[model samples]
Target: MGFLTKNKFTLYGVAAILLWSCLVALLRDVSELFSPIGGAAAMYTVSAVFLILVMGLPKLKGFSKRYLVIGTLLFVFYEVCLALSIGMANNRHQAMEMAVINYLWPTLTILLTIIVGRKKVSLWVYPSMFVAFLGVAWCIAGDAGISVNTLANNFADNPATYLMALAAAFIWAIYCVVTQKLSNGKNAITLFFTVTAVSLWIQFAISNEAALTFSINSSITLLLAGVVVGSGYALWNQAIIGGNLMLLGTLSYFTPVFSTVISALYLSVSLSVSFYQGVVLVTLGSLVCYFVTRDKPQKYNVKVTT
Candidate 1:
């Protein structure tokens, strides 16, 4: 009991991972009920409403409208790309592929920190990132029967899907770097509300389907995704504040692995050997990057907002 109390940060970190892992599977279910845009709209709307009820109206006195608007736009971009990456996929396997590909954001964030912020990183970080991306290539190639031609064909056929996934990664990397200069705490709540409102309107304008669909599974999943996953951000923030940032960052590499496993179990999807190989290489590369950076004097401390 005493030990558990002492290591609460570890628990928070684990909870964050569990909550984040469930997001992909939950979103996949929600996507079945709504279009990609519609699903994002519903999730963010629910999340915003739930947050408002819990936190009351966000205090906006000190925050400038420009900053708030920029923050909101960033959130919108991230969510849309994220939704398209998953919702646009034809199946759970493809969704996991996009999801793992989106996981590249963390590494992108690192690189951006080095370039944009002029932060110095260890030399080994570059090779580690290379190895990690090789894992992604292996997974994708493996999915196409390890044939280069098939891999090229797959990308050519589903250019939008692959592009959206990559865009999600790039957008998130920018968001992490940009948000650091903006607000945290209550301001984050405000950003959530703004994103929710804007996304709902955009969804309505673009989607032909009616707003809101009631189903047992989808409703439950929305609750988990909107409330549970939404709240998990706070848990993650706590973990980041209390725990070793490098360790937490390293552990986050497991999110794609967990997402893949959860999706496979829940959706009864079969994972290919290449998928496993990719997961191993990606996870290994991320760990290597973290370890190499761990001893550096100036570490990239960008917060994971989603």
Candidate 2:
């Protein structure tokens, strides 16, 4: 109990990292099986149920209006952008491409943190970020590598899905940084999950999405994805509030690599060497950004603030 209590926050962060690594594959599976918008709605519903059972409903009485409103909006919007980007993909290969695009948050978050802290960043930081963006181009271009024709053609093929993924990366970076400020030592993740679930259902209803059909595989994927989605958020909330943010933030960039491995096998997308190169660049650049501010611990001082 003593050791567990002392390191619980760090453990939570680690667990969230591992669970989220599986999310891209699971998210793609559930989206394909359940029908994009409807599938996302169902996945969130299952996540809400899982959270309610695990943590019960969050107490709303003390949550600040700013945190309650803004936090909910950012989280829900980010979730929608992420889910829809994958769901709207013209194909599973595009879904994997979108996942790579979403992994840019680690660099974005670290950059935002350095700015928020008003600290002097290493000169290499900007170049690292540039390299990371280049990686998105590389990953998107596949074996074509990074070039005007290939990059433009690839992204143009599915402009909306690519755009949404780009938006998701930015939105999540803001959420990771701002959530600490607004949370007031309170974790509203449970409440946010509930709201996201409800909002998605509404979107699913109003849309022209096909009717959802039941499948044993779909049901099983939904259950697993729900647990991953629910527990990942809950644990991430705890980690941000009290865990080692620097470590977790650095580790977060691994999403692309893990997403590549998991989504490739799960979705049966045979990737090229160039795609793996992009994953490396994305992860490497983000990791460099994290170290750029290593001299300033408070730059990553992401603990809950009132």
Candidate 3:
């Protein structure tokens, strides 16, 4: 019990991963009942309402409007792209494929920090990034039945799906960079409200379908998604701030693993051998990149500011 309390951050990180792992399956289910935009809009709306209840009104005094706008836009972009990537998939397996590809954001975040943020990194980190890309490629190839030609054809045919996944990665990387720079501690809830409003408006503009249908299961799933987004993020923020950053970063590599496994089990999707191989490779490569490049006693100093 003493050890558990001391290592609570580890538990928090794992709990966050579990919540996030449920996303692919839950979103896929919700997408069956609602349009992509509608699902995302509903989820964000619920999350916003939940946060409002928990955090009260945001204290926005002296907050930078520019930061608020930028943060809201970045979050909105990520949510839309993520929704489309999963919602547009033909099956849970395809959604998992998209997720594996989108999981590259963590690696991209590291590279961006070194390249654009001008942080110095070890030479070994570059090769580790390459290995992570190979893992993604392997995952894609496995999804294509281990045929290079089929892989090419798949990309050629469903370019938008793959592109959206890649875009999610890049956009998230940029968002992390921007968030690090802006680090506004007090306006997180306000920014979340802004993002939720924008997402809802976008859904209304694009989707002609009803925001929700009258189904108990769908309502439960949507509410669960909202809880995950709202509470999961709050827990993650606490972990990042209070926990050992290096250890937390290392554990984060398990997110995609958890996501893939939960998605496969919940969706009853068969996993190919190569998929397992790819997962191992990606997980290993991410750990290598993190451990090699990670500074000791790493601190985000962002303060849960959205």
TM-scores for every candidate against the unseen true structure: 0.87, 0.90, 0.88
Candidate order by lDDT, decreasing, is 2, 3, 1
The RMSD (Cα, Å) of candidate 2 is 3.1
When summed lDDT is taken over every stretch of 10 residues in candidate 2, the lowest stretch is 297-306
Ranking by TM-score: 2, 3, 1
- lDDT tens digits, residues 20-50, model 2? 7777778888888878889988998999999
| lDDT of each candidate versus the true structure | 0.73, 0.82, 0.73
RMSD of candidate 3 to true structure, Å: 2.9
* Model 2 alpha-carbon miss at residue 203, Å: 1.0
Off by over 4 Å in 2: 1-9, 114-118, 237-246, 294-306
Off by over 4 Å in 3: 1-10, 143-148, 184-190, 208-211, 298-306
Tens-digit lDDT track of model 3 for 24-130:
77777767777666776777777778777776667666567766778778767776787788888867777888888878887887888788858777888989898
Q: lDDT tens string, model 1, 1-306?
A: 997877788678878787778777777777777667677677777777776765567667767676677777877777777777788787777888888788787777777867886767789889889978887777777756656797787788678888988888888888777776766433565356556657666766876766666788777777767887666665665676566666666677777777778878977888888898897877777777766655452444635533
Pick the winner on TM-score between candidates 2 and 3.
Answer: 2
What's model 1's overall lDDT?
0.73
For candidate 1, the per-residue lDDT at 298 reads 42
| Pairs with backbone N, CA or C atoms under 3 Å apart (clashes), candidate 2 | none
